[model samples]
Target: MFKNVLSENIWGRVVSEKEPVFEEINKIVESNSKLISKLNNEYHDHDSTIKLLSEITGQKVDDSVGVNLPLYSDFGKHLSIGKSVFINSNVMFTDLGGITLEDHVLIGPRVNLLSVNHPTNPEQRRGLIVSPITIKKNAWIGAAATVLPGVTIGENAIVGANAVVTKDVPANTVVTGSPAKVVKTI
Candidate 1:
């Protein structure tokens, strides 16, 4: 059985949950988890929390980026945030592949951006696939929305509350419901 799965864009390399690469990724997760714990528990300084997030993610998060506390992520290094982004509380980012939020993006409370998934085949169920999720500039994701792997929300698009986004959303569109269908174009 083929244990290695080829990821399209996340890493552009062969990946397998059973391989050493997954182990390394797990270590990153573990370390970041501790830092995120501190970030959630200690809430005196917002700047310090952002600094810790930047350190864990290895990205220069702009000062203008406002992320409310109690955010969670499986891997922080794979996340990249653009300028003037507002992420509300209780957001979960599973960025094993990558999750990019462009400038002026607004993510509402309890939103989930996930980028890692397993294959359907039980024999290869342990195999993991990583895909990048991109929310373009000025997009707004409503409260409790879940953006799945490889999804790209286009510029100025709006995902309605509690929507489960499984595919790419067009630019200047409003999407709602499970699987996220475009209801109107802005």
Candidate 2:
């Protein structure tokens, strides 16, 4: 269903909303949204939730993963969750550009992992910029943090609560504040 525009090379490209490809993408997003609603509202048990999530992503989600619902994703097909990953409630993943959470990753409540943005130029603001976001193994993203497009949180790193991460975080470090900076290295 998503063959027209779901390519690895889609990263960093700006796609106009008026394009036919955008319509195709929108359809997929809408369909996924319905499934997400079921995940948030209908399914309460862990097994049932994971089964629905697997259907949403078009992949087999591992049973080792745990997600507290009310989880949201704009484009579900691009999200990849590894074994033993735990995602808290109220988390939003705008994963159109792709998002991968490696094994042992912990996502706290209300966190936003956004891999899609718009052009800064007002005239081209309707055009979408696609980028990937990766959370490496053992990384813990604290409550209410926002990880922006193209950012990677390295293995064993900790993102402090409410931080806005705009750049890559190195491994074994603790980062805090807006445009999150490494405050300590482990």
Candidate 3:
């Protein structure tokens, strides 16, 4: 079903909602949403949750990774969680383009890692723009932070609580507030 519609290089691609390809994408999203709902509601233990996450990603999730319940992802297949990563409860990942959480990353509660967005132009608002989001190794994202599409959180960086990141964060820095600005360097 996802022949030309989805691929490894889907980043920066635009797909209109009117297109047939979008229907195929929506179908996958719907099916994955059901599994995500089950993961949120039924699986409370660590092993069971990781097992379901592995099923969602179509790969074996490492035993070293830890994730709390109520995790959400619109396109679960595009998410990559590395070893020693700890994800808190109620985190959301819109990983259509792809979202990579590198090893030893720490994600606080209610964080949103968005890798897909709609066009800014009103005429093209119905279309979706694919962009990848990468959280480098050992990075820490505070509670309720929202990382926008195409942004990369650098290694060992810290994102403050409720920060809205719209651009790439430099390594070993601390960023806070909307459109997140660097406040300190570690």
lDDT of each: 0.85, 0.89, 0.87
Ranking of models by TM-score: 2, 3, 1
Per-residue C-alpha lDDT of model 1 across residues 1-186, encoded as one tens digit per residue: 001221223354446667766677777888889988988888647688779878767877888989888889878888888889999999999987788899999999999999888777788787777788999999999999999988999999999999999999999999999978999999
Q: Name the regions of candidate 1 deviating beyond 4 angstroms.
A: 1-14
TM-score of each: 0.92, 0.95, 0.93
Q: Write the per-residue lDDT of candidate 2 for residues 32-114, one digit (tens) a residue.
A: 98998888878479889989989888878899999988899998988888899999999999988889898999999999999
RMSD value for candidate 2: 2.4
- Per-residue lDDT tens digits for candidate 3, residues 72-92, read 999888788899999998999
Check candidate 3 and list the clashing pairs. Answer: none
Worst 10 residues of 1 by lDDT: 1-10
- Pairs with backbone N, CA or C atoms under 3 Å apart (clashes), candidate 2: none
**How does model 3 score by TM-score?**
0.93
For this target, which candidate reaches the highest TM-score against the unseen true structure?
A: 2
Worst 10 residues of 2 by lDDT: 1-10
**Model 3, clash count?**
0
